[model samples]
Target: MGREFIEIFEEWAKDYDESVAGQDPQYAAVFANYEGILNEVTARSTGTVLEFGVGTGNLSEKLLQAGLDVIGIEPSQAMLDIAKEKHPELTVLEGDFLTYPVSDTPVNTIVSTYAFHHLTDDEKAIAVKQFKEILKENGKIVFGDTMFASEIEKQAMIDSAKEKGFSALAEDLQREYYPIIDTLEDIFTTNGFDIEFKQMNHFVWIITAIKNKE
Candidate 1:
């Protein structure tokens, strides 16, 4: 589903931690309060979680530390390898937002951070539809990712990035499917979820969507 970005992750696997730590100025604002964002996602998650895009297992480690059972899914082998190396006991699989294996145990929550933008808007809707089928009633989806309030805001961000000489950031904003809040609201509610959005930083927002119906 998100394999289009596999090569980027392959190259970024080793340096992901540093990039998120604000070492990469081009992405510092994008990853601002990086650990805090992960912690917020972890705090919102519940039992038997399925984590999409578990890059380097940072959020996975936090989930485990909080005593939650987590199954991580990543499409990039290089990224998954790093995650495995970091947490030898972490349960992980090769998958993406639109494809993955599920255990017999019912998944109570699904959590992801900074990764959902890989999917286009249509794909995002499809993923949410599939998630509703897999989760138990009232199960939650907690995601911390970059999102904009509107098309105007999205364009403004791109312009700002360009003005700051952040061509890479601007290009990333254009290339990836960083969605608008209204579209996300439509997708979740149309898929039978009760959703809420909370701002985490200038570039990221925490989306909490609960499966409210069968």
Candidate 2:
């Protein structure tokens, strides 16, 4: 799933920012919500932020404005180049999120916006453990992205779209396996992190999880 988007992003990285928000009202709203949640969660912190999938520096720029030292990880060189150009001060690393190695310095907050969903559920679980390793004690992971809550909801959403003659959309939805909210909680909990999940406008999901603070 993650790999699929990487190829597309390489070509789209140049105009990604404007297109992400400029397409339509709904898209603009979604982009706004993503920035808002990332800001809201990290507002109180003053530390290094390790942002995964730092595409075009959209959220990384936001984090910088919030007063955090930013280290961005991106797989696409083209996308990373844009990010570096936008903020040369930013330490943007070009590598896969699953395999990218964090510097020896521990991170205070880890963030990924609208990007983490590219991972399959199992890959996410592995990433969670890797995140725990690089974070300082009591560190947090704040994620805001596309997600669902269950198979029932997933199927129901697909059915509704199909019934409305949205067959093409339904087919795309069927092929994409988004992370479920309840399942995400269990994954985080099982991994020794405490989590909070919220659905915004019933389409976007915001997740905040703190590493094993105990």
Clashing pairs counted in every model: 0, 0
Off by over 4 Å in 2: 22-34, 44-46, 159-172
CA RMSD of all predictions: 0.9, 2.7
Worst 10 residues of 1 by lDDT: 99-108
Global lDDT scores for all candidate models: 0.93, 0.76
**Candidate 1 lDDT by residue in tens digits, 31-126:** 998889999999999889999999899999999999998899999999999999999999999899998988666699999998999999999999
Q: Candidate 1: deviation at residue 6, Å?
A: 0.7
TM-scores for every candidate against the unseen true structure: 0.97, 0.85
Scored by TM-score, the top model is: 1
Q: What is the lDDT of residue 157 in candidate 1?
A: 94
In model 1, residue pairs whose N, Cα or C atoms come closer than 3 Å (at least 3 residues apart or on different chains), thus clashing, are none
